[model samples]
Target: MADRIISGRTHDAYMTVRDHIADGWAASVCTVPKDAPKGEELIKLDTVFEREDVAWKSVERFARAELNNLK
Candidate 1:
């Protein structure tokens, strides 16, 4: 699957899904600072998931909630 990005005015949420070498799937969520240059800002890993669907849904929900909180 392709990476998903949720952009906000001052921040963006970057969602990445990948296949785990051991087994299952892995998903990660990172917050990007819009003001910083690419690769300059710190990216924090939120969580990992065993299922693709669950990871997608969780990231979407997290992005939405973060956007709402910013408002």
Candidate 2:
């Protein structure tokens, strides 16, 4: 299967964990890009197989650490 944008969260320098919580992807692990900074842990989100937009909204509401990760 192709790599999907499971998570789309932004960390403020660092965050403990980032994962997908939709379409059976809630427990899926997030693999950041190779270029991602070491200290910068991105919030990993799993997009629905064919409903990416819907999945995004779920995660965006799940976390509210201050930073608008959706934007």
Candidate 2 local lDDT, 1-71, one digit each (tens): 23233333543222222234543333122334444754444445434333444444554444332234444
Q: Count the backbone clashes (under 3 Å) in each candidate.
A: 0, 8
What is the alpha-carbon lDDT for the whole of candidate 2? 0.38
Clash pairs, model 1 backbone: none
Worst 10 residues of 2 by lDDT: 11-20
lDDT of each: 0.71, 0.38
Candidate 1 has a TM-score of 0.69
lDDT (10s digit) by residue, model 1, range 5-62 = 8888778777777877676677766666766544653444556677878878977887
Question: Highest TM-score, which number?
Answer: 1
